[model samples]
Target chain A: MKVVVTGGTGMIGRKLIDSLLAMPELIDRDGNMAEVTAITAFDVVAPNPPLPDDPRLTIVTGEISDAEAVEALIDDDTDTVFHLAAVVSAQAEEDFDLGMRVNLDGTRITLERCRALGHVPRVVYASSVAAFGGNMPDVINDTVTPNPQTTYGVTKVIGEYLIDDYSRKGFIDGRALRLPTIVVRPGRPNKAASTWASSILREPLAGHSAICPVKEESKMWMLSPRRVVESFRHAQVLDAVAWGPHRVVNLPGVTGSVTESLQALSRAGGNSARARVTFEHDPFIQEIVDGWANTFETARGLEMGFKSDTGLDEIVNVFLEDDLPGQHVYYD
Target chain B: MKVVVTGGTGMIGRKLIDSLLAMPELIDRDGNMAEVTAITAFDVVAPNPPLPDDPRLTIVTGEISDAEAVEALIDDDTDTVFHLAAVVSAQAEEDFDLGMRVNLDGTRITLERCRALGHVPRVVYASSVAAFGGNMPDVINDTVTPNPQTTYGVTKVIGEYLIDDYSRKGFIDGRALRLPTIVVRPGRPNKAASTWASSILREPLAGHSAICPVKEESKMWMLSPRRVVESFRHAQVLDAVAWGPHRVVNLPGVTGSVTESLQALSRAGGNSARARVTFEHDPFIQEIVDGWANTFETARGLEMGFKSDTGLDEIVNVFLEDDLPGQHVYYD
Candidate 1:
């Protein structure tokens, strides 16, 4: 079996690669468990900390929107593709053309490449809860129609549609998971509006100060990094019949407020770690966050056996177990 | 003010051009009624029956996906655009690449050109009820999310998202109408599965035999050619505030079964004309039609003062008043 992972240099993508390497098994095109013979990690840049030194692993880098490059990346023998490359929400909003080029055009190029292969390779796409916004119901359900307000969200929703149509046409066996905001992401803050969700937990645990942008009561739809990687694996192995006609699902996630996140932080690293966080309201980020649907009824995803972290503590613990040891700012 | 209409040689586009010349006015970018200065009619082919001899109408033929050609078509002087170009459902399904090229890429090219002009032009796009399919409510309401089941539907839905994002960014003032299947369309039957909706009325009125591919009980969400034209005008003229945040709507249309359609046919052309229709059960067409949501509660569209044909009689009468005189097969 051969696997190709786009955006394999990113946090979730790297972790997913690690998990894939550890397991070395997935349901092949023939609907049977098979040993992973080769894994190609394709991205705009090579992995930084470096991926595991395995004979089967190969790293390749190129622009996702470039047709020739993507064609080269996903060759005839490719059995599965994990498409995670994207311009994040804030960055997409700031540079509309870049967002359209990389996120929207990039996705199409990848899908078109897969279609060209003609073997109906399994494609796992990383969609987001950013799929929901503007005049949303209190709690989003499986039936809620996506009305994404941001460019990134629009692109993600569009990608889901492309996946569905491609799957319907038997060009590709595709599944899109609408992920929630990932809590405890092991990195410095980037362009995402929800970066604070991770920073409040990650920075404090690594003995650094963090700013809380939104209010204590502002809740976010969240999942742990560990659970999300697990979801990608589960999504791949599930049979086509299990997904039915619709190829997209809103993955199960826990709703956590800033206060709740702080409590979890306190549980892990005591009062001092919790005290390292301070509120400095950024109205722009607040408005954007406020627009997102923070609660969900993921009955469809649950029925398919996809899981979320038990609570914020579990989310915090996942970071401690997997990411904390390698933290650059680690202190006693 | 100048206007550009893509697919302007098609049935609806030709009629819209006729209406524009007759009126010679539309709401300008400055939010004031202005004289129709130049109306550029762009399509893949020239009109068959010939458009009006009015100097304001200039017919240009070219591929819609050709970015340079589109750049030449929509100049900086362009004030509004009626983007009706697309590959219909059955045709798109038969040739996926053609559909993606014309329907998807063509729309992007059009929008990008408008954005480069730096002056936000009002854009009215012709989406379809094909935007709604698969597991659906018995009566689709304003809140129903689009889950298009075909390649054409997917492209239209994706176009809607692009329009929304562009509008949000103030790049273009965009409005997308999810039109019902048009009944009593003039000229010959095309590749659309819903062509029978028009053929049952159009062919018989022209003293030509027509085939009803589905059962009498089969219902369709339909609109008259005149009403849809009026709806497009209304959509173009309405202020951005009227649309609020979401720039798309399921246009108000009546649900008419084949029995009701034939009854309207009988009223206009009498029983003999109705007798020109014969049933030839096509399971393929039936399956496609069955997937569509035939009933809609377009409260939002109605509130915005968009109108549907009063009933099937009005639809039949629309054909009689506007198109019957020029019927290619007229023998009555």
Candidate 2:
């Protein structure tokens, strides 16, 4: 089976690629465990430190919104596609046109290219917790309607609907995972508003000071990179019947405030590491964080066997174990 | 104020045009009642019976997905846009590409054109109750997440999100109405699964026999053409504060079974009209209708002062009073 991964150079994408390489037998369309013969990593930019030098793995760079590029990337031999390319929250908010072009139009291009292939390929799309916002329920359940306040959220929610529709039409056997804020993201903080969620944990653990923008009590729904990759693999193997007609699932996640996260930080890195975190409230970030649905009851995801990190400590630990060693070599 | 109405030659669009012509005023961005100086009615095809010959109304034929056409149709002088153009349900199901091109791509093009103008026009988008389907609660409320079962429904729901996002970004001041299946339609039945909802009453009232394709107990959330036009006008005039961030509303509607609709038909046209209706189940159509959301509790729409027909009887009366006379002259 030939597999394609968009955004293959990003954090989760890179980890997912590594995981796929290590254990590459994915369930094919005929419900059989097939050997992954080839893997294509398509993205806008090349891998920074470079991906595995395995002969089975090939990396290609191009614009996701470019239909011609996508067409060349996904061909008849492609058995599965893990589409994770996107502009993060804060960046999408800053540049609406760019966000729409990449997130919305790019997704459509990918889906259309897949549909043109005729043979149904399992497509695992990355959605987000940003799918819910503004006047949300105290605890967002599976039934809560997505009323996203940001362009990024809107695009993600839109992608889920498209995935469902395309799957229903039998164009593609698709699954969309509404991922939570990934905690302890490795290397440097990027443009996402929730970047602080990672910075507060990742920076302190790495013996560097990090700014805590929001109040310590401000909470977020979060997951670990390892669990998210596991969820993606699990999402792919689940039969079409397991997904039923609605193709999107909000992945189960642990909800914690900065105070809780800091406690976990203290547990792993001690008071010295925890003390590296300093409070300097940015109300702009606070208002955006306050708008997110922090508490969730992902009954469907749990039932489907998609897992979350146990808590903030486990999330931090995952970073320590999986990403911490390589962080300095890549960024600094 | 100059206004543009896409799909302006269709049933609700024509009536909406008449309502606007009669009223001649709409709430401008300044929150003042401004006279409608010009009304451009844009559609894929020319009006069959031709629109009102009034000096203010100009009917233009063009494809909605044509960006250049939409740009020309909606210039800087345009103060409001009623984006009602779309491929109806059954046809969209059969021709997936056509539906995506016209409904999804068309909407995005229109939004982009509006955004380019920088004037922020008040856009009243026509969504549908089709936005809700699949495993639904016994009663759909304001909070039920849209899990559209059909391609048509998917496009409509996607349009609502686009409207909300555009409004949020200050590119357009937008409002979307999740309309119910319109009843007692005057023309020949189109490809919509719910066309029978109108046919069961319309054909009988016009002294022609009609087929009831589903069981008598199969119900639908319905509204009248008159009321829908009023809803559009009301939706446009309400201040942006009333809409807040979420610009979509499930417009108020009454749920009525086929038996109930037939009784209303009988009341208006006697047993003769009721007798004209005969049951002949088309499982294809029935199954599609069964997937629709038949009941709703539109609290937000009501609070915002959007109204529903009192009952099925009122719906029957609306056809008789507003559309019945023109039915023969146009179709026959």
Candidate 3:
């Protein structure tokens, strides 16, 4: 089996690649183990820390908006595609044309290329909870309609529709997972409005002070990097019959308020670690966060056997084990 | 105020144009009546009946998919746009690329041109009930997420999202009306899967035999041409504030089974007209009709003051008064 991962230079992409390399064998549709022979990490830039040496892995960098480049990258041999490349929410909102070009047009190009292959490759799209906003119910479910208020959200929702339609037409076997905000990210803060959710937890645990832009009570529906990567793998191997008509699913996650996250921090690294976080309310960030649906009734996702983080502490612990290894923890 | 109506040669468009020319004045944002100086009827072909020759009316025939042509047509002076042009369902399904070009890309071009004007124009989009399908509820409501099963439906749903986003950005004040299947259409049947909904009534009423492709129990949510034309005008002059955050609304309509419709036909033209209809079960048409949601709870549309045909008889009466004037109704 051959696979392609778009946005392969990003943190999640890198982690997912690592997991794939660790277990190069995946279950094929006929219930037989298939060995992944070639894995292409296609992105706009080479991995910063550089990926671990693997004979099967190849890194190819190019513009996602370029149809020819995407078409070339997704050759006829490509059996699966993990499409994660996108402009972050804040960046998309700031530059409308850039967002439309990359987020919308790029996805279309990728889908078109896959369709052209005519082999019915499995496509696992990394959609976001941002697809839910604007006159939302208190707790969103699979039935609730997506009315995204942001350009990024709109593009993501559009991607979900395209994936669904493509799957329906038998062009490609597609699955779009509406991922929650990933918490305890290893890297520095990026342009996403939800960056603060991870920044507050990651920085403080690493013995550095971090700013919490929203209130302590601000809630976020979150998943760990570890679980999301697992989700990508699990979604790819599932029987096409399991997905049926709808190719989109809202992945399950733990809903945590900032205060609850801080408590989790205190449990993991004691009082001193929790004390490293400071509140500085940013209205712009708060307004964007407020529009997001922080709670979801993910019955469909759970029924499909997709898992979420057990607790905020577990998520923070996973970050510590996976990212901040060999660092000494300071006691209160 | 100068207005442009795409697909202007169609039945609804012509009726809307007539209504617009009759009034020639609309309520502006600041609660002032503004005179409509010009009305342009733009379409792929010239109006066959040649649209009542009025001094203020102009006919511009061109391809809707041509971006440059659309940009030229929707100049700065254009105050409102009634976007009704589309490749109907069956044609869209048969020719996917054509559908995408005309329905999706054409709408995008029109919106982009309006945005370039810098003067926010009121855009009334003609969406459809086809936007609802695939695991739908027994009765659809405003909150039901659109899961369009056809290419045309996908494009229309996409158009609604584009309009909502453009309006949210303050580029244009937009309203999308999800219209039901129009009944008693005067023209010959087109490529739409639901064309029989109109043909069953229209052909028989015109002293010609009509074939009912589905079973007697096959139900359709329907609107009259008069009510739909009124809806376009109503949607245009309403204050943007009235639309609020969500710009899409399911237009109100009467739901009737094929038997109910034929019974009304019997009432209007007696047994002879009803006898003119013959049952010929076409599985292809049946499949499409079965997928459609026959009942709706259009509270939003009702609350917003959009009206439906009172009954099937009233709809047939409108057709008689409007299309078949001076024709004798033979009673048994």
Candidate 4:
């Protein structure tokens, strides 16, 4: 079956596509074999992507918010829809109008199209821990009430509601996965609030010490790119009845404080790696890090059989393995 | 003390304005005398006001959503804002764009303007119990998370977030009151889904039987128009700190079934009123009513001293006494 991914040029989308490409056996159904039909991806800045040349893969380069583009994207063979399109936190905070039109309105058009279609498709929406903010309890569970503090969170919350409503109406088998910071992020970083997670690690590996915003005690939740991809794939085939009416669930991830992250870096890195890691606290980021939490009791997800990252050790190692392939790690 | 009411043309708005004009006690705080200086009310339609000629009241008629009109409506003497502008469920469910512009964007503009003027007014906003929908258990407490089910709820949810954000930033002392469905509604009938609560009794009063939406077994929450006024007034002067970080609180109300409502009507009617109450099952309305809910522990509001109409006997009497003044009965 053909899989369509919106916001395909972005960080998670790119990596997720790679993971999907790597998998030969995508549909694991009982007593039946399903073969790939096509793989289509799109973004605003049309990139000549390095996609599989096989007839099984088709790539489209356009803006997802465009109604015509989205209408053209979904076809008869299309069964899986992974919508990752959104203006990230920092950008959203800066430009309110752009955020609303793109994030809020964009999701609306996507939902409407899927709902208008006669048949239901399994839709995997990329929600964020940003969906929950304010003073969080030590471990936020699926049951904990999310009092979102920012525009970004509000938009996602609305998107979740739309997805949930559509699912209830039998429009689509929608699943919204609230992802944490994907540690050891690949590619160039944008102005997203969580970009520091990558900058702190990426800069150090690239022979430069990065500024650490927020306090050492400030904590955050994280998952590896590999795990993120796995979560997306898992959402596609999860038993809808088993999930019950809960279309949205908090994702499982490793929660760690800046101090713990730095320590892990030291353990994994030699003197050169350690030297590249430094601290420079910024008040704005501190306020956000304190307000936006990372530790959540993801009991619902775990109970549903979704696993979490081992720890910061595995998280850092994934980055080291992929980016600094030539470097040896003491922890490993 | 010019008190500007954004949605002053609405049912609760009219009652609230009447109460404010009658009592004049709202401005009892030392510097502000408990007497009306003027009343500036707005709506999409020409504010067909009751024409309060108490000499102190002045009505400025215009659309609250129009920024210029809102500015023109406000004067230097205005110290309070009872922002109640919103497209109700029936309208919101039909049009998404209208709901967003009215509920969410209008709120933002109002708060932003207040923020700009450095005027942190005592702004009492009208929220709804609908904000507390979806997977909600019986006897929902104020602390119990709001999982809004409809588009109207989404806007209210975002409105609460914006109110809290403004309050936290010291822009406005925003108080969000989650109002229960007001029963025995006065004036012309409305298309609000909850109107059946008032219609069933009102129609029968006019010697006509009404169709009962949903099964009689379905339970939901409700309040009277007077209680709605009381809740709004209470929110105006409540301790901001007591409201704490959460400006939103579910107003307490009666928990009962449609049969309970009809039974109360019959009991209160003494054969005369009994003839008017009849039930015919409509599947569509039944479907909607099945989704309607009424019940809240509301311990938070309880501690803060908010009250709901208790006992169908007492509630039915309140409706009769308030809406149908001459009609009264002592139910055994």
Candidate 5:
């Protein structure tokens, strides 16, 4: 089976590709294990640190919103597509047209290209918990309506709708996973408001001090990078019958307050690492975080066998083993 | 204030135009009464009966998806826009590209045109209950996430998102109304699955036979042309602060089963008119109607002073008074 991963240069995309390469075979539409023939990592930019040199792997870089480029990338031979390309929350909010062009128009171009194939390819869309906001229940259930407070969230929700409609039309076999915030990110923080969630954990573990933007009681719903990569594979392999008519699902994740995450960080990197984290409340960031739904009753995601990190410590350990690799933080 | 009404030749659009023209003055952004200077009724086709030759009214015919045409129609002088143009449900389902071009693309073009005005014109968007479908509770509320089952519904929900985002950016003070199924329509049946909701009453009232495709118990959330037109104007005048961050609202409407609507028909057009309505179950129509959310808790719509017809009789009376005028239904 041939596969294409858009946003293939990003953190989760690179990890997902590595995992795919490790697997001996992939599940086909007929529920049979088939040999993976080729995989294309398509993105706007070339992969950093570079992908491994493998005969079956190919890296193509171009514009996601360009129809001809997308069509050339997702040809008839492609059986599965992992669409992860997007502008982060804060950045999208800052540049509305760019967000619409890259996020909304880009997703549509990808879906349209898949439809043109005439073969219903499995499209695994990466949505976000930002899909839920405004007046929400304390604990969001599967049934809560998506009232996105940000441009990125709106575009993500719109993409989910497009995927579902296209799937219903038999143009594509799609599955949209509303991912929780990923914790313990390996690299430096970008434009995402939720970047602070990872920064406090990632920076300290790397022997760097990080600013905690919100209160200790401020909570976040998060999934590990390893689990998310696994989710991409799991979602693809699942039978279309498993998803039924609705192609969207909110992935299950562990919820932790800022104080709880800090305590977990101490267990992994010691009290000195936790001491490296200092509080400096930014009301702008706090308001955006406050609007996010922290507690989710994702029964559908759990029932579908999508796994979540057991706790923050487990997430921290996964990051250390996978990303840091034998590196240790020194205490002053 | 100058206003532009897209889909100006359609049932609700024409009625809305008449209502607007009748008003001596309109409420401006500052809650002050302003003179009714000019009104443009724009559509793909000219009005069937031909709109009244009033000095203030200008009828322009063109494609809604054509950005140039849209821009030409809506200039800086335009203060309010009623975006009602769309591809009906069944037609949209059959022709996916056309639907996307007209419904989705058309809405964006309209919003963009308003944004270009830079004056932050008031935009009243016509969304639908079709925005609500798939797995839903017995009664839907403001909070129910829109999971559109059809292409048309998906586009409408997308339009709502666009309007809300644009409103947030202060490009346009937009208000999206999720209209219920309009009953007792004046024109011939269109491609909408809910056409029977009006046809069962309209055709019979017009002294012609009509087909009831679904069972008598099948319920529909309905509103009158008069009330919906009132809603468009009301949405325009209300302070933007009243809507706050979220600009979408599910308009309040009375719910009635097919039997109840027919009973109301009997009162207006007598048993003879009711007898003209014959049942012929169409599973396709039944399925579509079944998927619709018939009950709603529209607290926001009500609190904002949007109103619904008292009952089905009131709706029938509205049609008789507004559309039929001196013409009476003939009882055999």
Candidate 6:
């Protein structure tokens, strides 16, 4: 089936497109499927991994939040829609009007356009762990209730509902995946507060100095970029029975203190990578980090066949092998 | 302590305000004896229980959604804000525009006004189980990750965040209580779909014929009015620490199938109540009833000091003893 991926220029989106290109066996309810027709990548920024002269691939670059741009992306035969476009939490929380305009209005425009087309695709929406918040315990069971700490979470939680409602009404087949912070990202990190976690570890492994903006005692919930792609794929074929009332699932991740992460870096990178990393606590980041929820009860998702990284070593190996520029940054 | 109650003219609102007036010993919090100044009640449709002669009581007959109306509701001395205003789910889902106008807009207006006031008030927000929905199981947990089945749930979910955000920002001390459907209601029931559960039982017990619009096997979640009032009272006093990350708690209720409810009515009302009860099973009400969710993992709320309720006999007795009009025809 033809698939459309939004925010294709994002760090994780780049890898998602790569994974789509590799044509990995897709596990559906009926079992493994060998074919996918085409993958269309759309982004407000430039296309991530510019595909060229390939008949099965199309890179259409335009502002996803724009009506005309989104209209051009939809086709009667288009069967899959992956919506990953969003302003980061920091931007969204700081600029209220901008957040509403982009996150809220932009989403409405896309949904409305799809409604106008009268063709409902298998929509895979990218929701975030930010959908949850408040004074969280070490491990949070959703049974506790969602008390959002930010505007970003509010929009995402609402977006999940919109997707579910449309799906219930037969307008679309929607699946929302609430993703964790992706570590070991390759490119220049965006302005998100959580970026430091990845930037520090990734940069240090690559023989570059990286500063940790929050305290080492502060914990965060994280997954690899590949893990995020897996979540998107799982969303494509999750069983309806498993989803039940909520189409969104809490995607799994490794939860630990920043100190644990540092220890992992020290073990993997010898002395060099460890030395490149330095702590410089920023109050703003510290506030958010302190408020961040690092735990989740993901039994439903785990039972439904979704997978997660075994630990930080596996995450580190993947980044060192595939993400490092040239230096074989896997530790030594 | 100054307290502002919205939608104070309605059945529960009137009763709650009366209880607040009748009980003075229940007003202190955190070792701080309140400076009992005034009780302000605001409603769009009518004035609340007319406490006009009391120097400490003020009633404002204005739309709570209006910014000026909200401004008038909050003042320097205001200590607690009891937000009980909302359009019923049926009306909201049927009339899309009306729901957005009153439920969503009014909520945002209230939140904004609370924020602008600068002084934090103990804001008690009325939330509903309807906010959590989907293809519900035999019994669903309060934290089954809200996948709202309708527009009304969508609006209420947003309301929780709006109030929660204000609380997070230190602009208000907010608590969103997801109240169960209040049963054995002691007034002329409104147009809510769940009204049948009470109406059929109440009317028949008072020696009047009542229409039953759904099947015997249909299930619903319900609470007695006393329990609902008790939950509201608990909301105003729970220590912030006890609240933890969950600012919202799913109020406890009795879950049962329609056959069980009818059986309970038969046991309590004897032959007279049974004779007056008739089943028609309207398609409209059937759609809502069959879709209703009542089984909730309410252990959290029970631990948080919210009392449990389920006896229909108690509900019927309350209406029979206190609210039956002088003429028996009123029940008919």
Model 3 Cα displacement at B163 (Å)? 0.6
Q: What lDDT tens digits, residue by residue, belong to model 3 across residues B120-159?
A: 8889999999899988989998888899998888889889
Model 2 lDDT at residue A50: 95
Better of 2 and 3 by lDDT: 2
Tell me how each candidate scores on DockQ against the true complex: 0.87, 0.94, 0.79, 0.36, 0.81, 0.37
TM-score of chain A of each: 0.97, 0.97, 0.95, 0.91, 0.96, 0.90
- Ten-residue segment with the worst summed lDDT in candidate 2 chain B? B323-332
TM-score of chain B of each: 0.97, 0.97, 0.95, 0.91, 0.95, 0.91
Model number with the top DockQ: 2
Residue by residue across A1-332, what tens digits does model 4's lDDT show? 77888888776787777777777445422312355556787777654446555565566877667888888887656777889988887777677667766787788778767776656877889888887776667678777776777667767877787787668667777889998888878665566666778767766765667778777777788888878888887887787775777688888999888777777777777667667767777787677777776777888888877777799888888887765553223123
Question: lDDT tens digits, residues A1-332, model 3?
Answer: 78899999888899999999998876643446698888999899888778979999999999899998998899988888999999878788888888888988899899989999888888999999988898888999989999889888888988988898889888989999999988877777777788989888788778888899999889999999999999998898888788888899999999999999999989988999989999999999998899899999999989888999898988988888887652223322
Checking candidate 1 for backbone clashes, the offending pairs are: none
| TM-scores, each model vs. reference | 0.97, 0.97, 0.95, 0.79, 0.96, 0.76
**Which 10 residues in a row give candidate 6 chain B its minimum summed lDDT?**
B24-33
Judge candidate 2 at residue A237 and give its lDDT: 92
lDDT tens readout by residue for model 4, B198-237:
7777666655566566677877688878877988888776
What docking tier does model 5 reach? high
Per-residue CA lDDT of model 5 for A66-101, tens digit only, reads: 998998999888888999988878789999899999
Per-residue lDDT of A20-47 in model 2, one digit per residue for the tens?
9999989886778898889999889999
Deviating ranges (above 4 Å) for candidate 3: A27-32, A326-332, B27-31, B326-332
Between prediction 1 and prediction 3, the one with superior DockQ is: 1
Interface-residue RMSD per candidate?
0.7, 0.5, 0.7, 2.5, 0.9, 2.7
How many steric overlaps does candidate 3 have?
Answer: 0
**Considering DockQ, which of the candidate structures 2 and 6 is the better prediction for this target?**
2
Selected candidate, larger DockQ, 3 vs 6:
3
What candidate 5 gets wrong by more than 4 Å, as runs, is A326-332, B29-31, B326-332
